[model samples]
Target: MNNVEITRAGLPDISRIVEIENNLFPDPWNEQAFRDVLFYYSNTFFTLKSDGDIVGFITAGIEDTSEVLYGHIMNLAVVPEYRKMGLGGRLMQRMEYEFIVSGAEGSQLEVRVSNGDAISFYKKLGYSQVMVIGGYYNNGEDAVLMMKWF
Candidate 1:
């Protein structure tokens, strides 16, 4: 709620996104990965800005298969200083809104099993745990798959 603005991210924002990713995650996505997403999945990529600085971002995509289409949240992150301020929820809501507008039936994401806070946050947004995947992360951490039906 710090006057945050959500906007589509572009190539110019990848460096800053990479910086935040490296600082926040143990197995961070590199510049090339960001570049790939921005280039191929630009429509679903968004950045949260505050006073002209990038404070957070969410990367999502539409998955269409078997006559069903749904949204997939690939990554979501906010700077440590900006956490717990409802920014994460706002970002998610914004993405969900987009998904709803795009004819998506629901949204899905995977959270690290050890990330209790994130699991709770997703639960607060009406996401339910569907299952657990073993060794989902490169670091050997399990992941809890969560889904929300629109």
Candidate 2:
């Protein structure tokens, strides 16, 4: 972890990010989606590099509504080889810091209901389960909505 570097993701990083996404997720965001996000939320998109290779990444965006400004974490993934190395937590912390500085009142994300490990991870990060959305995923998996207020 000490040797890992966290930096804002660039256009050139999208292909690698898409690779990680496709490998880790049941339904991954395509290259175009990553590109759109990088274009629109560059500040909130980050990549973790170790030994000059991208090992993890997180993407977030500020959702401004009439009632509040919320940080919406869209996607997060770590290469299989890099899992459980505190890299994901580091990415979360970095994204949270950006949300705070960007005037977000809170942060939110959705995780698969069956993913207990991820749910516990979010809990450890101070997020509480707010609701469950049925058929949230393309494959009809229910999603647990989690939120944290800063």
Candidate 3:
């Protein structure tokens, strides 16, 4: 993690973040979506930089319901060259830490059901499957909802 920094993302970082999203996911969020998230939920959007280059990012937000307050991880991804270097896990840990500090009781996220690697990764991080949502993606794929209580 030498020379790597994790910081709150700004509008200036949207283009690079969008590039990563497009490269990693089939249904990527557009620039406007990133802009909205940064504008409305700035506290939960973060970017990872290595040697001054954008390499990864994670987006999450606090969800307040009548029953409970929790954190929802909306998106997370690292550039291919940065994968397996502990960057993803570090990004997740940072987000969860922020959530915990913000009084969230737990955190949740949805992963593509077909993404076994991601499922395993989340599981290793102590996230367990809570439910499955059918047709969760624009492409009609299912999503596995996972959660972890702090």
Candidate 4:
């Protein structure tokens, strides 16, 4: 992890972020989605770079309700070669810290029910499955709604 850095995402990183998104998910987010996150929630959007090349990213937003302010992790991805190196965990910790700084009481995210690896990862981060969203994805895959209290 020497020389690896996590920095706020900028407009220029969109193309590479989308490229990584397209490669990882069956229904990946488009360029405009990444743009919207950078435009609207830049405070919680971040990119991980190694040797000056973007290798991973996370997009999150803070949502306030009557009872609680929650941090929503909308998207996260790391280049295939960068997996299993703790880069993803680093990105997650960064976002969680930002959430705490922003006065959020907890964080929430959705994961494909069949994605055992992702679910396990989130669980390792202290997130627990709260519910299942039926037909959550465009392909009708169910999503497990997970939450972690701050």
Model 1 C-alpha lDDT per residue in residues 32-74, reported as the tens digit of each score: 9999999888989999999879999999999998788899999
Clashes of each: 0, 0, 0, 0
Model 2, residue pairs in steric clash: none
Local distance difference test values of all predictions, in order:
0.94, 0.94, 0.94, 0.96
Best by lDDT: 4
In model 2, which runs have C-alpha deviations exceeding 4 angstroms?
Answer: none
Per-residue lDDT over 56-93 for candidate 3, one digit per residue giving the tens place of the 0 to 100 score: 99999999886888999999999988899888999999
Residue range 40-111, candidate 2, lDDT tens digits: 999999999997789999999999998999999999998878888888899999999999999999999999
Better of 2 and 3 by TM-score: 3
Superposed model 1: Cα runs more than 4 Å off = none
The TM-score of candidate 2 is 0.97
**Which parts of model 4 are misplaced by more than 4 Å?**
none
Candidate 4 per-residue lDDT over residues 5-116, each given as its tens digit: 9999999999999999998999999899889889999999999999899999999999999799999999999888889999999999999999999999999999999999
TM-score of each: 0.97, 0.97, 0.97, 0.98
Worst 10 residues of 2 by lDDT: 78-87
C-alpha lDDT (0 to 100) for residue 95 of candidate 2: 95
